[model samples]
Target chain A: MKRLMAIFERDVTLAFRTGGGALNSVAFFALTVVIFALAIGPDRARLSESAAPILWTAATLAAMLSFDRILQADFEDGSLDALIESGDLLSLVALAKASAHWVSTLLPLILATPVLGLLLGLPAHAYFPLMASMVIGTPALSLFGALASALALSLRRASMLITILTAPLLTPAIIFGVAAANAGARGDALFGPALMLLAAMTLFGVLVTPAATAAAIRFNTD
Target chain B: MDERPADAGRLIAARDIAAQRGGRLVLSGVTLAIGPGDLFILRGPNGAGKTTLLRTLAGLSQRAAGALKRSDNASVFLGHADGVKAALTARESLSFWRMIYSAPPAIIERAISRLNIFPFLDQRGASLSAGQRRRLALCRIVISRRPVWLLDEPTSGMDAVSIRAVVDLIAEHCRDDGAAVVATHEPLDFGPGRTIMLDEAA
Candidate 1:
C-alpha cells in the first residue's frame, strides 16, 4: 500500500506540479468540444443523441495527446534504467506510470465532461452516467497508451506514434461511454454494459500492460 | 537478494558471458570479478561493444548469456541517455526518481544536494546544460545507496568542477563499501582504481 501510494504520489506530482501535459489535455479537450459544437451548430436534438460518444471520443483524443509524457520522460532521463536496475516489480512501476498518466491526461477530460456535455445539449439525466463511465473507463486508455508509448519509446517522435497506436484500442471506451449516456438520457439503467466495460478495461490494463511494457523496455534498451 | 560474502566484498562476477546483437556475437567467453571499494573501468574505442557489455552487466539485455552476482543490496545503471524529461523541473525529476528508487526521503534530498543541483532544482532538465544532466544521472547513485554502480560514460559532458564532483562522489561511494563499473574511453581519475581492458578479452 505504501509503495503504491509512493507511486501514486509521484504520478500525481507530475500531473499537477509540472502542469504541461495535464494542461495540454485540458486544452485539447476544450478544443475538441468547441470544434464539435461549431461543426454541429445549435441543433440540440441531433447533438443530444450523440453527446455521450462525442464527449468520450474527445476525451480519448485529448488523452492521446499526452500518452508519452511519463514513459518517454523516464526513458530519456535514465530513470527507466534505474527502475529496471532496481529489481522492483515492473508491473507496479507500470501501474504507477499508468495511474499518473490517467490523472494528468484523462482525469481533466473527465472533470470537464459536465461542461462539455452541456455544450452537447445533454440532459441532466445523462450527465451523471457520462461522468461515472469516464471515471471508470479512462484508466484503460492511460494503461494501453502507456504500453504503446513504451513500445515506441526508442523510435523517433514516439509520442505521435503512441497516439497512432492507441487511438484504435480506446474505441471501446467511446462505445460504452456513449451507450451508457444515451441509456441514461432515456431514463434507463446503464449499470450493465457501463460497469462491465470499465471493469474489463481496468482488468486488461492491470494484467497485461506491465508485462508488455517490460518487454518493450527491454527491447528498446537492447 | 543474496547475502554478502565475508573478506571478499566482490560486487560483481561474470563467468564466460556471451552476448549477441542482431545475430552477431558482440562479446563471448568474458569473465571478470569486480570487488568492493574498487572502481573498474572498461576502456574501448567507439563501437567496440563497450556499451553492450555494460548493458549486459546492468541486466538491461537478454542478448548476453552470463551469470552476474552483486554483493551490494542494490545495483544502479546509468545508460548513454540523460533520461531526464525536458518538461519536468530538476526537482520534479529527482522526486520522481526518489519514489521509484525505494530510498528514504531524507537520503534522497541529500543525494540531490550532493550533486550541487539544488540551485536549479526547479528548472526543467532540458533547460539545464548537458553537464548538469549528467550530474543528475550521477545523483541516482547517491540516492540509491546501492553498492554496485554500473555507469556508461559518466562524464560525457562536464566542466572541471562537475567532473571533480563526480570523482569525489565515486571516491566517497568506494570508501563506503561501494563498487562501480564505469565504461568510458576518456581518461578518468578515481584514486587507486583498476582498469580492465575489454579489448584484450577477444
Candidate 2:
C-alpha cells in the first residue's frame, strides 16, 4: 500500500511539473471545445443542443492526448524496470499510474467543464449531469487508455496506436455520457439509467484493466 | 579461479542458460554461480550479449533456455538508462525511490553522501551530468537493500573519482554479504571477483 501510494504520488507530481502532460491535456481539451464551437458557428440553440456530444468528444480526445505518455515515458527512462524490480505487484503499479492519470488529467478536465459548458451554451440543467457523467465515466477512459498505452509501449508511432486501440473501447462511455447529459437537458427520467450504465462501465474498467495493463507492460519490457 | 563449486548456499546458479534478443539467439551455453560476497564482472565486445545476460539475470528478459535458480528472489538491476525523470529534481527522485523501497531515512542519507550527490540534489534530472544521473540511479540499489545487484555498465560515464566511489560502494556491498554481477567495457577494480567473458560463453 505504501509502495502503491508512492507510485501514485510520483506520477502525479511528474504530471504537474513543468512541461508535463496534465497542462497539455487541459489546454487541448479547452482548445478542442473552442474549435468545435467556432466550426459549428454562433447559433445558440444548435450549440446548446450539440453541446453534450461535443464536450464528450473533446474530453475523449484530450484524454487520449495524455495517454501516450503514461507508460511510454517511464519505459523510455527505465523507470518501468525499476518499478518492476521494486517487488510490488505490477498490477498495483499499473493501478497507481491509472489513478494518477485520472487525478492529474481527467479531474482537471472535469473542473474546466463548466467554463467550456458556458462557452458551448450548454443548457443550465445539463451542467451537473455532464460533469457527473464525466466524473463517473472518465475513469474508464484513464484505465483502458492506460491499458492501451502499456500495450503500445516501445512501439514506433505509439500515440497513433494508442488512439486506434483505445477509441473503440471508449465508445460506450461516450454513448452513455452524452445520453445522460442530453436527458438532463430535457429534464427527463432517462438521465438515471444512462448515468447508471456509465458508472457500471467505469466500475468494470476499474476492476479489470490494471491487471491486463500489467501483463502488457511485462510483455513489452520483456 | 574458474572452477565451479558444488551446489551449496549459492545465491544464484544457472546452467546451460540461453537468452534471445529480438528473436535471435544472442547468448547460449552459459553456466555460472553467484554466492554471498561474490562480485562477478562480465566482459565482452559490443553485441557480445553482456547487457542481454545481465538483463536475463535480472528477469527483465526471457531466458530462451536454462536451468536457473535463486536462493533469494530479491535483486536490483541498473540498466543503461539512468531511469531519472527529467522533470524531477535529484532530491525528489531519491525521495520517490525511498518511498518505493520503503527505505529508512538513514539509508537514504548514507546513499546520498556516499555517492556525493548532495551538491546536485536540487538539480533536475535533465540538467544533471551523466555521472550525476548514474549516481542517482545507483542510490536505488543501496536503498533497495536487495541481496543481488545486476548492473550493466554502471561506471560508463564516471570520472576517476566517481568511478572510485562506485568501486568502493560495490566492494562494501559484497563485504556485507550481497552479490553483484556487473557488465562493463571499462575495467573496474572490484577486488577478488570472478570474470565472465561472454565471447567465451558463446
Candidate 3:
C-alpha cells in the first residue's frame, strides 16, 4: 500500500507540475470541440443530434493523446524497473500508475465534457447522461489506454503506434458511450443498461489489464 | 574468492545463465555467487552486456537459462537513468521514493546532506546538474539500505570529490554487511572485490 501510494502520488504530481499531460489534453479537447463547431456550422438541432458521437470521439481521442506518456516516461527514466524489482507485487504498481493516468487525464476531460457539450449546442437533458456514461465508461478507456501504453514500449515510436493499436479495442466503449448518451438525451431508460455495460467493461479492464501491463513492462524494461 | 567457506553469509546466486535482448543473444554461460559484503566489480568493453548481467542479477530482466538462488529480500538496482522527474523538486523526488521504499525521513535527509545537496533540495530536477541528478539517484540507493546494490556506471558524471564521496558510501555500505555489484571502468577504491569480465555474446 505504501509503495502503491508512492507510485500514484508521484505520477499525479508529475502530471500537474509538468505542462504537457492533463492540461494539454484538456486544451486539445476544448480546441477540437471548437473547431468541430466552426467546421460543422452552428445549427442547434443538427448539433444536438450529433453531439453524442462527437463528444465521445473527442473524449476518446483526448484520452489517447495522453496514453503513450504515462508508463513510457517511467520506463525511460528507469523507475519502472526499480518498481518491478521492489517487492512481490507488480500488478499493484501497474494499477496505481494506470489509476494515476485516469485521474490526471480522463477525469479532467470528463469534468470539461459537459461545458464542451454546451458549445456543441447539446440540450441540457443530454448533460447528465454524457457525464454518467463518461464517469463509468472512461475507466475502461483509461485502462485500455494504459495497456496500450505498456505495449507501446516495445515500439520505436510508441505515440505513433498507440492510436492504431488501441483504437479498435476502444470501439466498444465509444459505441456504448454514444448509445448511452443518446438514450439519455431522449429521456429513455435504456441508458441504465448501457451504463451497466460500460461499468462492466471498466471492471473487466480493471481486473485484467494491470497484470498484462506489468508483464509487458518487466519484459520491456530490460 | 571461493577460498572462504560458502555457507558463511547471505547469498544470491545465478548459474549457467544465458540472456538475449532484441532476439539476439547478448550474454551466455554466466554464473555468479554474490553474498553479503561483496563489492563485485563488473568490467568489460562497451556492449559487453555488463548492464544486462547487473539487471539480470537484480531480477529486473529474465535470464534465458539459469538457476538462481537468493535469501535476501532487499536489493537496489540503479541503471543509467536517474528516474528524476524534471518537474519535481529534489525534496519532493526523494520523499516520493522514501514513500515507495518506506525509508524514514532522517535517512533521506542524511543522504541528501551527505551528497552536499542541501543547497538544491528545493531545486527542480531539470535545474540540477547531471552529477546532482546522479547524486539523487545514489541517495535513493542509500535510502533503500538494501543488502544488494547493483549500480551501472554510478559515478560517470561526478567530479573527483563527488566520486570519492560515492566510493566512500559504497565502502560504508559494504562495511555494514551490505553487498554491491558495480559496473564501471574507473578505478575505484572499493577493497579486494571479486571482478567479473563479460564478453560480447557470439
Q: Would you list the C-alpha lDDT of every candidate in the order shown?
A: 0.76, 0.89, 0.84
Q: Kindly give the stretch of ten consecutive residues in candidate 2 chain A with the minimal lDDT sum.
A: A152-161
Candidate 2 CAPRI grade:
medium
Which candidate leads the pack in DockQ? 2
Q: Candidate 2 residues B37-131, lDDT tens each?
A: 99999998888898888888887888899777766555789999999999999988989899998889898899999999999999999899998
Candidate 2 Cα errors over 4 Å, as ranges: B1-8, B71-73, B200-202
TM-score of predicted model 1? 0.88
Q: Measured by TM-score, how close is model 2 to the native structure?
A: 0.96
Question: Cα miss at B54, model 2 (Å)?
Answer: 1.1
lDDT of 3 by residue, B25-89 (tens): 89898877777778898998888888888888887777888666666565789999998878989
Listed for every candidate in order, the interface RMSD values in angstroms are: 2.8, 1.0, 1.3
For each of the candidates, give the backbone clash count.
Answer: 5, 0, 0
Model 1 reproduces what portion of true contacts? 0.66
- Judging by lDDT against the true structure, name the best candidate: 2
Per-candidate TM-scores read 0.88, 0.96, 0.96
Reference-based lDDT, residue A194, model 1: 69
- Model 1 gets an lDDT of 0.76
Collision pairs in model 3: none
